[model samples]
Target chain A: MVGPVFTWIAEHPKVFWTAAQQHLVLSAAALGLALALALPLAVVLLRWRRAAATAIALVNVLRTIPSLALLVVMLPILGTGFQPALVALTLYGLPAILINAYTALSEVDADIVEAATGQGLSRAQIVRRIQVPLALPVIFAGIRTAAVQIVSAATLAAFIGGGGLGELITAGMGTLDIPQLVVGGLAVAALAILTELAFGLAERRLNRTRHA
Target chain B: MNWTLANYDRLFTALAEHVGLVATALAISLAIALPLGVVSARRPWAYAGVMAVTGVLYTIPALALFALLIPFMGLGTAPAVTALVLYSLLILVRNVATGLREIPHEILEAADGMGYGAWRRLVRIELPLALPVIVAGIRITVVTQISVATVAAYISAGGLGDIIFQGITQDFGEKVVAGAVVTAALAVVADESLRVLERRLRAAQSERA
Candidate 1:
């Protein structure tokens, strides 16, 4: 099993490299896009309890939709390709990022906010100097969750021509090609573990800075 | 609408298979996680070790795990269930361990003073107290597995995913909508029902307190 996979890797180094690169780019782009949309929306939602509640409820429903379904459901609407895949993956990532950001901001110690208010910090200044720093750890935790999840879900993008490592896995399955399957599975698994560990270390650092 | 009416039988069969797949995997996961969780809860090193192993298993992508299993397990419900069970362990075990570990020391002391042996105390008191958290974990596991199990259809483990995959390949919008809708509904129903059970258990615990 191992020998065959290694031989395949050696024979088609470019194919393996391109798939790995595509997987990374897809995962990264989705995480980046999710953060961009979710964070600002989370900030806005923080000030509105009713809207936050509704948005979170909607996200909860969205979360129940299977990742594959979410990807393919985009076919009719967005058509197949990297763009649709990115959109679906970003939506997959939204819940954790949005919920965590809103909760982190809202859960900042009320007394501290009061002190900041008394100190005459403007709303924007308080958000920048006080709320954001304190919320960073929790928000980072959410980001870590989103990052790991997005990486995993990005594999499904291959089914729709999103061109990720999933293509290798799917092709392997079609042909019962053990070498392709092993290589693809191992690469995706390695990427996911690496993402988890990287974010975990960053999260710990954030916590330490918060404490210090 | 017309497509769904024409294919209701297919839809129902897929939904049933999806439910069965999730149910069987969850049952096996709970059985394994409960004992492991209880044992690990009492031993910090064991907890860490078990978590480390399960965490890695949980980190692997669903499709990747399924792909890896195909050569060994062969495609079908078995490999799909195996993957689902593995994915669920991290969530269920962590929650179970945490639940058991969170029981107040004073409560355990009182149980001991009442002449309850370790086995009896666990069954009669600690497990009950921990029920809410365990149920909460089960809720998450079910919802997540529903989604994962849908993807299991790619391996020919029959489910609503079969319908969705067919729709994707055929470019049939109605089939995709039907599959997604039913899958989401199953998830929501499972989640809400487990949530109710969790809430009830919490209420009972608080009342006892």
Candidate 2:
């Protein structure tokens, strides 16, 4: 099994490399979009109880929709390929990132926020200087979780022509090519593990800094 | 292109298959995770390793995992169940261990004072107290398994995903919609039902002296 996969890798190094890059790009785009929106939105929304509750409820509903269904749902609206693929993966990632950031920010000590306010910090300053730093560890944990999830979910993008290692797996399945299946599966799984470990380390480092 | 009564049998079969796939995966996962969780609770060192390994496994994408399994497990139920059971271990283990650990020391002391032996205390008091949290974990595992089980259809494991995959391939918008609606409904119903069980456990927990 291992020998065949290795030989396949040796024979088609470029194919594997390109697929890996596409997978990374897809994951990164999804992760980046999710964080860019979820982080600030989490902080802002938490200030309004009704909005936060509504947003979170909607996200929960969205999260339960199977990614395949979601990708197909996107097909009519976005017409497949990169845009729909990114949208689907980003949606897959939102709940973890948004909920985590919101929960972390909500958990920031109220007294600490009050003190920062009394010290003449603006609301934004209190958020920036006080709320955010304290929320980093939790938010980082959420980001890590979201990142790994996005990487995994992005593999489905292959079904939608999203371009990635998923393409390899999808092609393998289409052609009944076992070697392609083995190489593609291993690559994506390795990517997920590496993402988890990398984020896990970052989380530990952030935690140490927070403690120190 | 359109939904018809003719498809009902297929849809129902897919739903049943999906349910069976989830049930099998959760049962297998629970069997391994419960004991492992207890040992980890007793041995703090084991907790980290167990958590890290399961956590990594949990992150593996379902399709990729099916890919990895195909060489050994082959297509259909075997690979699907193995991948899903692996995915479920992390959450279930954490929940059981946390539930066990969070049992207050006072309660255990009281159990001991009542002449409750280790096994008796575990079966009678500790497990009952931990039941709610463990159920909460099971709820998460089930809902996720339901969702993940759809993807297993891609590997010909036979589930709601069969409808989903076929709909997409056939460009049958109605098939896609029907499949998505049922899959979503399954997740929501399973999630809410387990929630009731979870709440009932909580009510029982709170009633305990």
- Which 10-residue window in model 1 chain A sums to the lowest lDDT? A65-74
* lDDT for position A52 in model 2: 89
Query: What TM value does chain B of candidate 2 have?
Result: 0.95
lDDT of 1 at A117: 96
Badly placed stretches (over 4 Å) of model 2 are B1-6
- Expressed as tens digits, the lDDT of each residue in A67-174 for candidate 2 is 777777657668768888998888889888899889888899999999888899998888888888988888888898889888888898887778899988988888
lDDT, residue B136, model 1: 92
Misplaced by over 4 Å in model 1 are none
Which pairs clash (backbone N, Cα, C closer than 3 Å) in model 1? none
The TM-score that candidate 2 achieves is 0.95
Candidate 1 at B130: error in angstroms? 0.7
Best by lDDT: 1
